[model samples]
Every structure is written in C-alpha cells, then in structure tokens.
Target: MVTIIKGKDRAEYPEFFTQLFKLRYKVFVEGRGWSLPTKHGLEIDQYDDDEAIYFLDVNEHGIIEGTVRITPTVQSSLTADYFSHLIENGQSPRSSRVYEATRYIVRPSQKSRDLNRAAKSRLLAALTQWCLENDVESIQTVIDSNTLPTFLELNPKVLPMGLSYPYGGGRNTHGGGDCMAIRWPISQEILECVRLYGDLSLLHAVDAISSENIGEMIH
Candidate 1:
C-alpha cells in the first residue's frame, strides 16, 4: 500500500525518512549520477522543506519500494525555482492549486518488469486520489523522453510546457536524456482512468494520512 507523509509529521517516522533518503541516494546519485547535495549517503535538497509532501509505496516489511515528492507551487518548487526556463513563454505555474512533483524513484530490488510497472501505477493512482481530494488542479514536473510516453498513456491531458533539452551525459551529472517540463491536469475522470489502468481500488490502493490522524498511525 501507499503511505502519505507530510513534512510536518516527518519527525514521527525517522527510520522511514532515513530509508527514503538512502533509496534516493541509490537511485539519483549512484545510479543516475545526479550532482545533488548529499551528506552521509543521503540524497536531499532545498525542496524537502515543511511545505513538501511525500508519497511512499512501502512493502509489507516496511521498506520503501517507490516514492515521490510534491511541493506546492505557491511556495518554492523545482519547476518555478529551477526549470522556469523550460516553460514555454516563461510562464511558470505559481498558485496554491498547482504543485510540482519530483524525485520519482522505484527500488531495483525486483528484476521483474511487471512488478516495477505495477508499483509505478500504484503511485500514480495514489497521487491522483490525493490531488482530487485536496483540490489540486494540476501537477508540473520535468521528465525525460522515456517517461513522457508513459504519462501520456495514463492521461491524454498531459501537456508539454516547453521544448525538450538535452540533460545529463558528459559534464552534466543529472542523468542522460532529453527532458521536458510538462503539466498534467487533475480531475475525477483522470483519477478513474488511472485507477482502471493500474487496476487499483480506492479502498486498498492508498492510506492517505493527515495531521489529524497522524498520531494514531504513529502510536
């Protein structure tokens, strides 16, 4: 199942955070060779602040198998702060109803392609559910060419914000590929499509936590 962890409640789950960061280190640093700030084998950045929310797909053993980060665009976000140039006409989304998603990673522990794809679909469904509940209208993110097709398959409403640029490779340490910024509109119809494509049930796919019931889960 997927677990929702808001930044304010991060202190309650230190071990989970530890594993999450290490997983990110393994994926982005060791695997993708991204030149990100690191300390003691943890991959972290300025965007991991109180305004950020994390979605974790944990296994039965409590290990984080897949994860993603969401930050409100009204505050600092990757798209607005860093990739504004990628947006066509230089109009970056900045509003409470819009958010930026980043740091999507899935553990490579399992070699089965089907398992990995299922995990990714689960995360996408969970994100769609949360956005619908919270009134988030859209998601802005930078993704490589390899991932764009998958996004388009899930939701035809996905729109590219600007032209793709060659990232990573050579001197660039952010992994190799042509990456572009895109915006995805959120709606009940979109959520249904995701749930159907992922074969996920709303009752079992996500366990969305909030500040009100966070203590109950912790205890």
Candidate 2:
C-alpha cells in the first residue's frame, strides 16, 4: 500500500515519519556515505519542511519499503539552490506546477535485481498518479546516470537538464556512476506507461491514496 503524507498532516503520523527518517539515514548516509544533517540517527534536511509531500510505499506489515519526497519548485528546490548549473542553459524551472523530487530510496534488503526494479516501478507509478491529480506538469530530479536507462524505459519523455558529472565518491558512489538532473512531464500517457511497466492495475495505482483510506490507516 502507498501512503500520501502532506506536509500539513505530518503531525498526525509520527511513527511513519520516524521510520522514514531512519530508512533515509540508512540508505543515504550510512549506505551511500552522503554527508547530511543527522539527529538521533535520522537523516533530514531543510527541504523536509511543511511544503514537502511524501509518498511512502508500505507493505502488509506496515513496514516502509520505499519512499520519495516532492517539493514545489516555486517554494524551495534542491536543484535551483545546489544544482542549478545542471539545468540546460542554467535555467532552473521554478513554477507552482513544477515540483522537485528528491530522496527517492528503496530498502537495500530487496537485493534481488528484479524485486528492486518492481519496487521502484510501483513507487514511480504512485508518484505519477499523485502528480496527475495535483496538476503537476513536470517533475525535476537529480539521478544517477546509470539509472537513466531505467527512467527512459519507464517513460520515454524524460528530458535531461544537463550532462552527468562525477559526484559524491566517484564511480563507486552509492547512486552509481555520474549524476545528472532530468525532468519528466506529467501526462496520462506517461502514467499509463508507468502503470504498464509496473503491471499495476488502474485501481491499485490510482486509488492507492484517498482521504477515507488514509483515515482508516491512521486510526
């Protein structure tokens, strides 16, 4: 199951966020060796403010398997602040309809290549659905160059903002190879392709999040 946590509703789900922070710490800090702010073993940054919306992929046992954070570019964007040079012609997209997705991670325990691929696909599908509903026209993100092919496979519409550059620990970096920024246009066709790649039924992907369902889960 997927849970959509709006910045305003974060107080209502303390445990979820706790686990999410730990998971992030495990993946990015400890695993990837990325230097980031840490408090009580939780990895967090300024971008985790109330303006961010989170998509968490949880299992039947309520364990978070994967997660992604999306923040509006008009507000505060990692790309605009840190990676603006990566943008094509150095034009970072800043608009209400444009969002930057960061901290996308899946638990490393799912070591099987196929399992990891499926888990990432599901998370992407859920994100695409939410973006479609929220009228998000484009999503900007920095990703490892090695994974660019996978993104293209899921949605051929991905546009590279700039060339990949060596980052964080060189070739053996946790994210893999060089990193680059890319933008994905949100549309029905893109969503459909994601759904098909993940083999997710329309109901499973589109109806994953709703007020009623969230209320039930929270209680």
Candidate 3:
C-alpha cells in the first residue's frame, strides 16, 4: 500500500523515513553514483523541506518499495530553483494546483522482475489518486528519454513541457544529459490506466465503479 506522508509526520515513523532515505541512498548514490549529500546512511538534501510531501509505497510488511516526492510549484521547486530553463517562457510554474514531483525512488522486488513494473504503476496510481482528490490539476516531473517507455506505461498522454534540455546544466550523470520536463494531467485516462495495470481501485469514488473489474483487469 501507499500513503501520503508529510514532514511533520516523520517523527511518528522514524523507521519508515529511514527505510525511504536508505532506498534513496542506494538508488541515487550507490547505484547512480551521484555525489549527493548523505548523513548516517540517509540521503537527504535541501529540497526535503518542511513543505515537501511524499507518497510512499510499502509492502505488507511495511518495507519501502518505492517513493515519490512532491512540493508546491509556488515554493522553490526543482524546476524553479534549478531547471527553470526547461519551462516555457523561462518561467517556472507558481501555483497551488501545479506541483513538482521529484526524487522518485524505486527498488524492484527480488522475487519477481515483472513485479517491479506493477510496483511502478501502483505508486503512480497512489500519487495520481491523491492529486485528483486534492484538486491538483497537474504534476511536473523530469524524465530521461531512455526511461520514457517505462513512464508511458503509467499514462500514455504524458508529454514534455518544452524542448529537451540538459538537466543540471549538463552536469548530470546521464552522458547526453538530455532530459525533459513532463506534465501529467490529472485526468480519467490516468485513473483508468492505474486501475487496470496496478490492480487498484480509485481512492476517490468514481461513477459506475465495481470490484469485479479489478480482478478481470489485472495483467
């Protein structure tokens, strides 16, 4: 299952945060070899401010499976603070309805390689459900062309905001550094895709919904 977590709630679940940060460290640092700051086996940075909200994917045992972070575009978002040039008109978004999704950390289940695919869909479904329920109209996230297929499995309509640009001013680990900022609309298509692929029902009630479709839809 996935849950929306806030910074203040960190105190109540130290183990969860520790697991999340450890996963982040494994992905971004040890795996990707990014020189990000780490402390006591936890990968943390400035953007993990008080305003940030995270949707965490955990198994039945509460072990972290994947995690995604979001923050208001009105605040210092990844695009506004660092990747503004990728935005159209060279202006970063500033609105409550729009949010930046970053630090998407995922670890595949050791038992099944295909389960990782479903895991991604599940986490994305949870995030999309939360956004639609809370009136978030759009979410901004970065994507590498190589991983575009993986993301497209979540929502077919996801499109880039502007021309591809070098992320981190070309200093990123990706040799070409060709990254694109994408916008995913909070729409029915995403909900349907999530419902079918993730084997999940919409958290927000939808008209003509039933549990029978869930079993029939799972791939």
Report clashes for each candidate as comma-separated counts.
0, 0, 0
Q: Where's the lowest-lDDT run of ten residues in candidate 1?
A: 200-209
**Of models 1 and 2, which has the larger lDDT?**
2
Per-model TM values vs. the true structure = 0.85, 0.85, 0.81
lDDT of each: 0.83, 0.85, 0.77
- Report the Cα lDDT for candidate 2: 0.85
Is 1 or 3 the stronger prediction by lDDT?
Answer: 1
Query: Which lDDT tens digits does candidate 3 get at residues 100-133?
Result: 8988976756645457667877788888888888
Could you list the CA RMSD of all candidates, in the order they appear?
Answer: 11.8, 11.0, 7.2
How well is each residue in 27-116 modelled by candidate 1, as lDDT tens digits? 889998778999999998998998899999998889888899999989867777776778885565688899889999866457566566
Tens digit of lDDT per residue, candidate 2, span 1-219?
788899879889999999999999988888877889999999989999999999999988889988999999999798888877777755656888999999998763557665676787788889998999999999999998889998997899999988988876679656445789999999999988877776645434645766447877764
| Alpha-carbon runs more than 4 Å astray in model 2 | 108-111, 172-177, 200-219
Better of 2 and 3 by lDDT: 2
User: How many residue pairs clash in model 1?
Assistant: 0
